[model samples]
Target chain A: MGNTKKNDRRDFLSKFGTAFIAGAALSPLISNASELLETENNVTEIKNFKGSFEDLLGGDYTNIKLRMQDDVRRALKKPMKDRKWAMAIDLRKCVGCNACTVACIAENALPPGVVYRPVIKEEIGTYPNVSKINLPKPCMQCDEPPCVDVCPVEATWKREDGIVVIDYEACIGCRYCMTACPYEHRMFDFGEKYSDGLPLVANYDKRPSFEYGKEWDREDRHSSPIGNVRKCTFCAHRLDEGLLPQCLTTCIGGANYFGDLNDEDSVIAKLVSRLNVFRLKEEMGTEPNVYYIR
Target chain B: MKKIFYILWGIAFILGCIGVAQRFMYGHELANYGNRVVWGLWVAMYIYFIGLSAGAFLLSSLVYVFKIKMFEKVGKLALITALVTLLCALLSIWFDLGHMWRAYEVITRPNLPHSMMAWMIWLYSAYFLLLVLETLYAFRIESGKYDGDKLKSYQKKLGILATIGIPLAIAFHGGVGALFGVVAANPMWHSALTPIFFLVGAIASGSALFTLIFAFFWDNKKGEYYQNMLKTLAKIVLVAVLFDVLLEWAELSIALWMGSPEHTAGFRAMLFGQYWYVFWIFHLLFGVVIPVWILATKKNGIAIGWASLLVAFTFIGVRLNIVVPGLIGEKIPGEASAYIQPRLTYNYFPSMMEWLVGIFIVAFGIGLFYLGNKYFKLTKENNSVKS
Candidate 1:
């Protein structure tokens, strides 16, 4: 018992020592990381200095993120019916990196067979004339959604705030809506995991996802989301939490924009009006809320 | 021959049980159908079997509604076939659902006025109830088994039920077609002609199945009466097939001649793609030419029996053509390649497990019919002279 007490004390002391060294080592990187990705890539402005430097040379758009955050904070104060969620993607800025796709997968805890957003790539020409285009497709959240009309059970519906939401508990997974959606955005969850054949399911695969603001643990194979069809919700949970979507947070291009279209002053609304923007399959009359600024 | 057939059935049933077990344990993972080509063999089979049920029930209408004396003996047998096949259709579609248990939601929280599938379910429910009533009345008032007022009451009830069922079957089966037709996204299935074609195909396939069942299984002596019945049933089958074939030709020709890639993609793929034999050989040669030739040439029981069987079985390939091709090529090109995974495939053929499960539905349907026959005596229970 005396030996155990000594060992425990030593272990505690060592842990403290390691944490102090690690914190000291990471302090500089942490401060730098906060300012590292804040500016637009081309920012070259000289500004009044706050630090010891003669002048601030760049980072003109460093506070742009804060401004967007403030916009979201203000929007969240309004009633649900008064808010209309929408997205604007600048196609010229997208480099086809697919960081947004990866981040979305992480955020949703998507299994192997299910995906909400995938970056669609196309190479336009041959050899020296080659140019590539990337289109990141998510659920359109149409005002007149064909998917909503095709479901035998009323498992999916558009929210008052304009996000299309599926009740995983109510979805029978018939996949009728999948066929009806011209964009083919809805994906069926075939109850697969990343570690399907392995002895232990991957750690992240077991993580609970907060979708539709509900805690969904995918440990049970015969559970709600497993046997149900799923789609993008525009990261409504994060919107409710006054934060940007994981896709928007991770997009290296600064191409993805999300805000309320109902608020004319919102970023998405401004982008839609300022640029040559259009929704996919406008002839289908789905009234898609997502717009692409080409 | 009978012993050999029973042994083969036993083997198939055992294999089917393994498939059913696999489906329950692993879910859709063991199945080949994925997100892109969402419907597969089972969906084809669901429509095929449901078509057969609708056809068989409609064939019974000749006896009960139209009061045709020639088709007097076919009513009960047709009803039994209808019931059994309908049960199989329900089973096949239920199994296709990701959450089979939640299928009750179609009834509980249905989205009607917008969903053709919801309309289909409601119509099917009504049809199922009417069918049960009609079958009960038919059974209770069997031939040479009812008295004066009892006979009239049973016949009157049966007549009323059949009258309701005719329109019910058309609406439900047409609604099934409309279910595909209404999906304006898929240009191939969006045509207004789809529901009409489905109705006629159901009659063609369903009546043919009933005729085949009657030819071999009915416990009637191979006399003048039997030969007359076979001739009449075969003629009905032949006419229905001709009508269905005509409609099919119109669709193929129009789609091919006015070849927009989007509209003609499914048809071109059906005719010339990898699984061309499904359309050319299975559907055309076996389903149409051979059956039509045999049926037109002779009216013998043996000849009509084989011809009807060919038409009934090969119609499955036709149903497959309807489902798979519509969803085949990239509706949006490169969208399939946009995300790479096993289930995100654009091309599909049924896996072995799928075929095995199909066999199970058929075997289960036959088993139920056998029990229904033994208990209810839908057809006369007597010995048959094998050729």
Candidate 2:
């Protein structure tokens, strides 16, 4: 009986040892082959390897990715309700310094004869009882986005992130979008350059840590495909880096706030909850991103 | 007589060429189009020409489908004018587009359901095809190439097609008007009646234009049939002008009654401000009242011809008033009023390039018209022989 048990133990030990050795041997070979395949495919395997292993180990990277994907899926699955981003302007806080207008123009690198942001000076009452209100206006970035709706080429679209962006390459310069926009925020890029020294401005370079969104070689202003309608992007390029828009940063009166409305703790969320905010042209059903506070 | 026609066409062609050159070199800066007046004379001209095309084609349909033998001489001429005017309308839009090269993208990447202009593109293309087919059928009949049996059979078939084309023409112009009417942003153009008004105006202006063209042909001794044609056309013009007046009055009255500050201000600009004279004297009196009076009261052929000339002349002004004033209103209160005056300091005129291109297109149209007339025997006798 004792002899039989010893033989059995030896057999078990040998089988276990061989299986371990085979696994160990095959792992490197498989990994190396995959690495070679990755090189051939011009893809870095490290990027793919990250979350898969983390998922197996229940790590935070996997959790975050899953959570983000779920959130996106859920948001998309739901019916479009209050999907439009809106802003309320507090007429009480705005001062007629024109800082926001200037900053927006500088950030957008707007050519001569184009103004992306403009402040309207209004007198509310007669001379004695008159209250001067300086209203700074940007592209309303409407939910319905009349500009996007009317673009014949589907060149302009509302992003999942709540900004309307124009694909310069696809736009046909029909100007139908400009005519459709009630806010009149849309502008035609008429191939005007800054060489005439009308206060030359470069918006992207003005920021300290600007990353190019789309690859465009400098020295070709016309390369952006002129004749397409353009408007304020709410500083989408800046937001990608967790930075505020140039207009929001440079507002002398601190009238503008940029934040995620999804976050309850965000400044915009808090202000919207507390203040009586109103959008321009609510009757039009555009559900604009910009709001005004009384 | 042919030499004079050629001379006049040549002059117009040269002027149009100069306009196109100005546009190409300097951009729309040559035109009196700015932020305030984003649409101006070119857009007005586009609508005017489109109206003329639609009107002339509908008249030709009367001869084709209704078998109006008295109107036979002007039928081919109407078709030619319709085709030519359609070309002019297209040229005006081409000039208006900021990126003319990217025009093909409008078709290749069409945004379905949302774009009114895209719908316009498709509708206009279909209408143009219908016009081409109709023109060919007319040609075949006039040339006597088809025997009586074939001609009768073809006419029977084409008459049905021509009937379908009348409503299509109405829809085409009405759709163009709807393009503006649907833009709720511009209150002046946002009325439900806008499409109806556009259709009515189209018929009125179209009849007026045909009257003028026919009278010119008659005066030049092109044919005696034009005199009888003008007499019939005068009655059509009178009715159209009266309807146009009623619609204009109703549109304004509704705006006034609405009592919206923007609508009121826009109406005031048309009635009393910079556009007041254009609204009152040009569009109202000359376009509607005076032309209607002369057409209705005058019996003399020369007087009727002059009345038609007045109608044609003033319709251009009416189109301008329709397109420009609404765009010129305040986009946002407390901001600068979007109104633009036609002064050199504030606005632009069509530069040489713009003129040249415009001339080229007009010349091209006339040249095509002349070629069409020469190749096809466009006379009553020829048409009768085939039938």
Candidate 3:
């Protein structure tokens, strides 16, 4: 009975889309009349499937997106104190496409030399026996962030939700945090532009990055962030808006996962409990929220 | 000779003006130091000048705090050198700052105890205040402002100031080293010996510089008193240099002894990689070996002056060696090749603008010294001010 109900809704949505396209064709003013229409029973077949793109491609995924969306909605229902956000990256699945890196840049409007996520490519063994490993690094957002304690002005701190954030206005750009960070995730903005050699600064290059949900313009040299140290905040702004982090959503291999770790049933919680999971620089005792599965 | 010196100073001043203009007009965009190697020539120079100031101030305390009469004549000179170098050191760091104006936040709203740099700034401020008061009392004593009882009281106050300054100078310079040492991420600088190394290096370089000034610029160079002072200062510099060499050897050999890849990579880069000449040619030969040779063999003031000048100038190389090597290696192997950008590379050299700014700082210091000598009566006893 449940399966039939899902199919009915999926079929109804596809029919509605076709009708809308047909209706638009009757009006000469409508543009791209053919491409606007989508015809596929994949939606109908996977109506019960949640969010992962595997659902569209007929893979037997647990519907990670749908489960995560539900998980997000459920977690949001609880007070902020009960939430502990975490990220898990499965190294075996990552192909080093760097799509997540580019998506993060676009989402954050990061300038040149200010990379928040960089995929480290390494090869093990010798000659023909060699195997490639791609590790994507982001700010650890450690429970005891070394970068936080070294800050001379207390400009950066770990949020209650487990994201380490910087107050750009308060940061003095001493680069102490940059040196203290073992992972070297922090970047100092020297007011460089991607639009160098262009006749003018490109409009897109000048667009404000909405980090921490605050619009920051990079037009001026003396602006808060232009001379401040910057790092990843786990896409905190997107998390608050019921969206998974941009990097997780854009990972082509579905290697990355993020959710509230406080929920025992969440994907991240289950992943963290696995023995294969590990963190970078574990001996440093930073207790980072981001974990990797070997 | 004087005219030629003036001309050279003029040329340097104008060139430095261009660099300073570019710095303010464009910001660090012109500097080659990127995110990975975040500091460069200016930072090295800052530490170098601060080392000079601390070393010279500590030497002056021998006259006031310890009452070593053999060092009496150069006490005022050492004080002035400390003050001037402190200014230059502060300026170098200010220019290096990404936000030059926000530096006061370190004082106004410091995150104390947690930040080593905050402690450094506060200690330097206290040291600066003490220095100024100490200089005033020293001048008042020489300016003939009081009778026997009053003069004795002034001397007592100066002694107290110098005694207080001993710890301030040690803390400030040690704090400079601690600033780098506390960075656990960079294995090259993470050591208990770092602060001790910095303190000893400051004494070595600073005393060498003071000895040179006394040898070359003292008015009564032909007198027996002058010759005796020059000999004693040279001996002091020699001892400091020997101590500094011992520390340098300890730092180098310990890192490279076991051939541990992680521990020795930065040292290897300093010794064998590009710009290796900075450590070998500029520092080892010109800074240490030659100065040590001249100070040991020659009793003449002129020879000591020449040798001490070489040590003083080439100490910049020592400063650079300390800073750049620690940042040369990648934290993770192959990390440098992972991302390719001008500002992302493990390799670094100061940009042309960086060199020009450094030249300007040196020229500015020389010009200030010249003015102080001529008008402030820095080299004269009981000379009246023109005003």
User: Which number leads on DockQ?
Assistant: 3
Worst 10 residues of 1 chain A by lDDT: A48-57
The 0-to-1 C-alpha lDDT of every candidate, in the order given, reads 0.83, 0.67, 0.83
TM-score of chain B of each: 0.96, 0.87, 0.97
Q: List the residue pairs that clash in candidate 1.
A: none
Query: What tens digits encode model 3's per-residue C-alpha lDDT throughout B296-369?
Result: 99999999999999888899988898788888888866678777788898888999999999989989888887
- Taking the tens digit of each residue's C-alpha lDDT, what string does model 2 give over B1-387? 889988989888878767776667655544556554566666777888898888888888888878888877667778888988898898888778776777787678878778777777777778898888887787677666787789887777678778888888988888888888888888888888988888888788887877876665443344455556667889988888888889988999988887788777667777887658888898778777777888888866677777887887688777777777777666677545221123212233444554466567668776876676555544333343434
Report the Cα lDDT for candidate 3.
Answer: 0.83
Error of 3 at B194 (Å): 0.5
lDDT of 1 by residue, B124-228 (tens): 989988888998887777745677998888878888989988999999999999999999888889889899999999999999999999887777646677888
Give the per-residue lDDT digits (tens) of candidate 1, residues A1-294: 122234553343234333333443454676753354333321221122122111111223343344455567778899999888888787765767788888899898888867888888888888756656789988889999999988999999999989899999899988899889989888888878888889988888888888989999988877878878899998889988999878887665566888878776666666676547888989899999999977
Output the worst ten-in-a-row residue range by lDDT, candidate 3 chain A: A33-42
Better of 1 and 2 by DockQ: 1
lDDT of 3 by residue, A51-151 (tens): 33342223333345546656666787888778888889988667687888899989988889889998999989987566668899988889889999888
What DockQ would candidate 3 receive versus the native complex? 0.56
Ranking by TM-score: 1, 3, 2
Candidate 3 residue B87 C-alpha distance from true site, Å = 0.9
Off by over 4 Å in 3: A1-62, A77-81, B381-387
